[model samples]
Target: MYTGNLSNLILNSDSYKTSHWAQYPSGSEYLSSYIEARKGDYDVVFFGLQAFIKEYLSTPITHQDIDEAEMVIQAHGLTFNRAGWERLVDKHGGYLPLRIEAVPEGSIVPVSNVVCQVINTDPEFYWLPSYIETALLRAIWYPSTVASVSHYCKGIIRQALEKSADSSDSLTFRLHDFGARGASSQESVALGSLAHLVNFAGTDSMTALVAASRWYRMDKDMPAFSIPAAEHSTMTAWGRDGETAAFANMLTQFGGAGKSVSVVSDSYDLWNAIDNIWGGCLKDEVQNMGGTLVIRPDSGEPAKVVREALERLAVKFGTTINSKGYKVLPDYVRIIQGDGISPNTLGSIIDVVLKAGFSADNITFGMGGGLLQQVNRDTMSWAMKASAICIDGVWKDIYKDPVTSRSKRSKKGRLALINQTQGQPKTIKLDDLSTTDNLLRDVYVDGKLLIDDSLTTIRERAGW
Candidate 1:
């Protein structure tokens, strides 16, 4: 009897799901459902399903889990399907008799297209597909929404870099993940940060690194990188008078040839730190550091502060015009706007910096709550709905047409995601398309993980 109090898959769902096994049609033997970003601002970056599978679904549910779940369900005044759960444990060894097909991890699928499809493999477990919807939908939405937001930010940065810089070489590091501390949990940060890493290669989230290594097979080559950087505590510990000393220590410790380090420079005052401290007293040291000293401004409106800071830094440290006619910060100096950044403001900040005649390369962003914790499931309008069902071995189309909200109208029949060759993928009837043409691949089948994707492969699928 496995008694470890870790998560039990049987109980990892909404309480209402406990009674769903008895509510399905009398002769129902299988249920087919699909998940998609119904309609949203950005295409879904299909990702993190592999992590969900490895973490939750791959493990066999023990008889101990069934017993414990039944006890809890009954106590909650919900009907527990003891017979169904016991049957699953005995017949399938607690492995879900379901097949999960999804777009390859990191594939950017347009909104309203199927990102994942679920169907129970065993005829006896008709409710299994919908029963797992709570976990399955959650596993897809949060990470995919974060990835979509990150991808949107990347697009904004790409446009800025192309217009203001000589090359887009610095694009990957233009946005850094400072989201670990702001996330709700270590698991949340791990998944959220990994989503950001799909488009960018910088992060301070250690859990994301472990997640990528463990689930995405990034051990041999780590996917994300972060430089030694200072925070408020580190800078403020020196007192306002000792702020310059603290900044100097950071450069001395982490600065070297062809290296990078970040230091928060707005402890007492942003203007004084840039003008007197960094530009006046420490100008020589900064210029001679043989690397980049990324100065971070934590307060004030991001766009306005970055524009002002760039002007002051240009006056003191000097800047050269790039090939794109934008002022490029010297090799040793840069800026990072870490506060108050979101999808709306990130582009605005970059636009301000670029419009000030500074190259996009002169500034990077460190996002905290805006990157990880700000979004919810509806940010992408994600939902999983039952689309088809098999009753007494007869398949039929099914859907929910909610008159209250036309956007909530669910897809119908067994679905297949097929690339249109010119535009985004289209969700069509599975019977209408050949299996080879379907973008949705069988990633998980009856407890077996079929596609073990690496972070590199996923990145490539997301356009790197």
Candidate 2:
């Protein structure tokens, strides 16, 4: 009854687009006639037949392919259905719907937390198990990954800010979700990046624009406002003569409306480039035009380059160029370091840069690839198992062999999750069947999803 735009979206998205349909036995029909008769009551089995059929229908598979695939899937579906149907019908006449309680999207949850739960309403609905596995796993895993990474990046930004006295004056840089396009699959790139961008404030205007238009119903031009706000930001090139010149020309064109620009200085001889080419007239021109200059170090020890640059600037402009009282010279030009900047590397870089008498506030980071693609397996692990079953008019929790690698173990009977804040955070799993205190709530019920979140909303909630 809470139907609205979400329901319409789901239905429209799920509906068959082509003028084609597949015929299959109804779930009830299969259960009563074939399943119950063949398999005895009170058995546990996975239900995936309908889901397989639905998946096949959604594709551009030819009729012949569908028939072949359906033959194989239906056999498995019917086999499980027979076992599961007899158990549910003869024992605990299915009454309860499956209940699932999961962490809200964008929340950073630790390992061993009950990130999700799946339960059945009627004992008979136990047969619906296999049908929901992939969806349930994906619903939790992808968002959790994005949330965890976003949390890490937030910490990095916080640390960088904390090391400086004038942190308030430091640029609040955007966290671009550049990984989505190059690293992930096409569909995932579109949706996953949107989901990531919800938490990571991306500098990639195009991704932000697309996410805004599709998910937020806003125009693509919204993020353009960020360009001018970060107008004096530096640009980087390969540090080669040709690369630097090309990049400078492009920046000149891009900053045509009197925008300030920064150039990469380490292409040939960084000292020569800065002291001779960039340090002389170009620096004067940019400053005279009321624009700040920035120099980026792409290769060779960043600390050394930043130290030299800082020393040069301090000697050249003893009073420093204070743009709006923010101290643009001495520490005038910003130093941006790009390659291999992980948490440890960043900490080391900051220590060195600070030691070299450069204000930590005068530096910016352009991190890509490394931060986004790196995954520490120890931080997260995934597992799926059969949690419950109806046996002889009773629902029993299923447990697995503790020592076995594939031990699909779960707590017994109707499980309730109790969230108790005692010192360190903890979750107590209760086995009492009578207690419904912390039963999992439904995120998607009766094939109707309960939540439809946008990337922007996700990003805001994630606080990245």
- Worst lDDT window (10 residues) for model 1? 1-10
In order of appearance, the predictions have TM-scores of 0.97, 0.64
Residue by residue across 210-304, what tens digits does model 2's lDDT show?
Answer: 54455343323453222321111232333344544544453465444435455656655767666665665455544444444556666777566
Candidate 2 segments whose C-alpha is farther than 4 A from its true place: 1-99, 120-127, 168-174, 180-182, 205-251, 256-265, 289-294, 301-332, 376-379, 404-419, 422-425, 430-441, 454-457
Q: In TM-score terms, which candidate is top? A: 1
Find the candidate with the highest lDDT and give its number.
1
The alpha-carbon root-mean-square deviation between model 1 and the true structure, to one decimal in Å, is 1.7
Candidate 2 lDDT trough over 10 residues, lowest sum:
30-39
